[model samples]
Target: MSSHRPPPVPPRQVFTDPVHFLAFGFGSGLSPKAPGTAGTVAAIPLYLLLSGLPLWGYLLATLVVIVAGIWLCGESSRRLGVHDHPGIVWDEFAGFLVTMIAAPAGWIWVLVGFVLFRIFDVLKPWPIGWVDRRVGGGTGIVVDDLLAGVYALVVLQLLAWWWQVLMATA
Candidate 1:
């Protein structure tokens, strides 16, 4: 058995590096424990602001984030000389945005989306796990999470529909 462990990706220099600043989810990814979870939690307020926008506007903004995330996340990983460091969580921000598209109207569902997104992200089932391993650079880093977001989005929509049905019945 080869005990080959890649060296740890160092913490971000949030103040010194702009790429790090964004990739770290404005510092939420810098948390010593569960940085990914921290980044997901930090996304809530941003999601709130974005949710107020018209659906098109929200989707447009999310599109911009995803497109730009490819570069931002890639460069940050390169600068750190690491591939998809746990601390580089711009993907999480972008992923959470993806999960929120057409989400139900309420903080409750937002929380639900967060949990679902996290589950998909952490679990990396199916193509998510495949992409995470097969892809490289920023595309790999962000795409995996983006896929997870898509999965979460589907589950969230289903939940919304179920909720609507329940409310209608009541």
Candidate 2:
């Protein structure tokens, strides 16, 4: 039998045209290096825009983003024949949303959350790293960032609480 290899797939599109710009996180994934970092950076404006919403509204929106991200990331990966390509970054958007949920409503908190989430995401400590390696497809792409978001949330919450306690005691 003659060896037959599949033709090379084209480079993935960044935004699927203009209509899907927001869905693709504003082409942040197209960054030349550290695309995940770029994706997370792209989320800052969105976080600022949504941070003004009422607490319940913010939480609801975050939930929607997370649920939708799985499908979007998966679909793009399917088209590209790659698993978790850097250019597919709906996960970063969802993770940023999760990080902002219940955070103190201020620029300082926002910056802190952003830094913390990026750190944990890049570091991928413990089960986060494990999940990143073992899981496949869209679920794998998103789950690690989701866990990083959780870690950031927990740490920030504890820090906020401790700050409050310290201030009250002082």
**Per-prediction RMSD in angstroms?**
1.9, 5.1
Using lDDT as the measure, the top candidate is 1
Where does model 1 exceed 4 Å of error?
1-12
- Global local distance difference test of model 1: 0.89
* Model 1 worst lDDT window (10 residues): 3-12
Q: C-alpha displacement of 111 in model 1, angstroms?
A: 0.6
Residue 73 lDDT (model 1): 93
The 0-to-1 C-alpha lDDT of every candidate, in the order given, reads: 0.89, 0.80
Q: Write the per-residue lDDT of candidate 1 for residues 12-96, one digit (tens) a residue.
A: 3675788888888888877878889999888888889889999999999898888888999999889888788888888998999
Question: Candidate 2: where is the Cα deviation over 4 Å?
Answer: 1-12, 18-24
Q: Can you give the lDDT of residue 105 in candidate 2?
A: 70
